[model samples]
Target: MTARVGVVTFPGTLDDRDTQRAVRTAGLEAVPLWHRDKDLKQVDAVILPGGFSYGDYLRAGAISRFSPVMETVIAQAKAGMPVLGICNGFQVLTETHLLPGAMLRNNHLHFICRDQKLRVENAETAWTRSYEQGQEINIPLKNIDGRYVADERVLDELEAEGRVVFRYEELNPNGSLRDIAGISNAEGNVVGLMPHPEHAVEPLIGTGRTDGLGFFTSILKRLVSA
Candidate 1:
């Protein structure tokens, strides 16, 4: 059977359709999951795409953390399901404590958007297994609250466990701590990043480069093999 990847949509979310397209582009079935829905529709994996959920009110992803869909996503992720969170979705992961870290306003306090270069710090995660460790790729990044922050101890722990999946290369667009761009759970099943990989998956869309396609393809390969 073809692997089904769920793309969740919350009110104010602006990237669900693009994310679903990215999933379908990877030869996987794209399943639409609504914020108000409690069922996952039995997807093999899930993606929380980028966008200004709840208009970033209260916090970028703070309000969406309590949405009905996240309750099951949180549990399934903890049970070893692959979950990828991008941009505002990354904020939601932090808000739900699914990933360790907090996203704050950019140090410059400005919304940053551009093609970002990232080094794959770890490639064993479900969402990044197709990339090589230390490999560099360019992905589109856009956000106001993109600065990733975590306590020193937690940062050290993540580093010690090889959970830092991606790191900013060349330029730190949002002043993320240690130039961290993305991280994964200890089990490597849950990953989150401030960059919008979905935006970079297709050529002629953002930068005419498909460097971000590996993310969607990586998870599809993992699910198919499983």
Candidate 2:
């Protein structure tokens, strides 16, 4: 059977459509999931795309973590379902405590947007299996609160466990701790990252680089093989 992936759309989410396109491009059926709905529609995996949920009012993803859809995402993710969160979605995962650490305002105190280079630190995660360990690739990044921070103990634990899945290659655009750009859960079923892989999936669309296609394709292979 063909794998079906769900792209969630929260109230202010802006990348759901682009994420769906990336899903379909990876040869998987793209399912639309709503923030107010509690059902997952039996999708093999789920993706929480980027945007300012709830206008980034109280905090990025702070309010969105209470959305109905997230309840299900949290439960299923604990049950071993694959979940990938990008940008603001990454903020949600942190707010939900599914992933360790939290995002802070850019060290420069300004929203930054650009093509970013990242080194694949852990290629075995559900969303990064298609990449090679230590592979350097460029993905488009855009965000205001993109700096990732955690306590010293938590950061050390993540590093020791090999959960730091992606790291900034050459530049630390947001001044994230340890230059960490992405991380995965210990089980490798959940991943959160500040960069927008969906934005870099199409060669003709952005900077003519499809380096981010691995995120979608990696999950496809994971679900199909299972």
Candidate 3:
């Protein structure tokens, strides 16, 4: 059976369509999930696309954390379902406690928009299995509240567990703690990052690079082989 990947659309989300397109391009069915719906349509995996969810009010992903869909998502994720959160979606993962750390304002206190360089620190996650460890890729990252922070102990734990999946390579764009750009849960099923991978999936579009397609294909490959 073809892998069915769900792309969630919260209110004010800007990249849901892009995520769907990327999923389709990767040969998976793109199931559009709504914030108000509790059902997941039996998708094999879920992607929380990047966008200004809930208008980023009360902080990014803060308001969206309470959406009805999240209740199911949190439970499903804990049950070993693969979940990938991008940008503001990353913020939601943190708010929902599915992942560690919090996103604060950029150290520069400015909205940054650019093609970011990130080194793949861990390529064993469900969403990154197609990448080689230490592979460098450029993806679009545009956000205001993008700084990642956590207590010393939590940071130490993440580092010690090899949970830090991605790190800024050349320059840290938002001063994220430890130059961390992405992380995965202990099971490697839940992954969250502050970059717009969907936007980088198409080659004829912006940077003409298809490095982000690995994320989508990785999940599909995992589901098929399992």
Candidate 4:
């Protein structure tokens, strides 16, 4: 059967369509999931795309974390379903406690939008299997509160367990602690990142680079093999 990947759209989400397009580009079915809906439509995977969900009020993803759809997503994610959260979506993952750490305002207190270079620190995660370890790729990053922070112990644990999946290369855009751009759960089924991979999936858009396509392709490969 063709793998189906669901893209969740919350009240203020803006990248659900782009995420669906990326799924299709990766030869998978794109399933639309509404924040108010509890059903997942049996999608093989789920993506919480970037955007100012709930207007990013009271912290970026705090409100969206309580959405009905997320109720089921949280359950499924813990049960080993593959979950990928991008940008604002990453904030939601952190809010929901599906991923470690928290996102704070950009250290410079500025909204940054740029193509960021990242190194694949842990390619064994469910969302990064397509990239080789240590490989470098450029993807667009845009957000006001994108800095990732955690206690020293948690940061050390993430690194020690090889859960820090992606790290900023050369230049850290948002001043995220340890230059962490992305991370995965211990089970490797849940991954979150601050960059907008969906925006970089196509070669004709957003810096004209296709480096982000690997993220979509990586999930498809995982679902297909399962």
lDDT string, candidate 1, 1-226, tens digits: 7899999999999999999999998899999999999899999999999998898999889999999999999999999999999998889999999999899999999988899999999999999988999999998998889999999999999999999999999999988999999999899999999888888877779978888889999998899998
TM-score of candidate 2 relative to the true fold: 0.99
Residue-wise C-alpha lDDT for candidate 3, range 60-91, written one tens digit per residue? 99999999999999999999999999998999
Clashes of each: 0, 0, 0, 0
Per-model C-alpha lDDT, please? 0.93, 0.94, 0.94, 0.94
lDDT of 4 by residue, 93-130 (tens): 99999999999999899999999999999889889999
Worst 10 residues of 1 by lDDT: 195-204
Clashing pairs in 2: none
Q: What is the lDDT of candidate 4?
A: 0.94
Q: TM-score for candidate 1, please give it.
A: 0.98
Give candidate 2 misplaced runs (Cα > 4 Å).
Answer: none
Give the CA lDDT, 0 to 100, for residue 192 in model 4: 97
TM-score of 3: 0.99
- The C-alpha RMSD in Å for every predicted model, in order, reads 0.7, 0.6, 0.7, 0.7
Model 4 clash pairs are: none
Per-candidate TM equals 0.98, 0.99, 0.99, 0.99
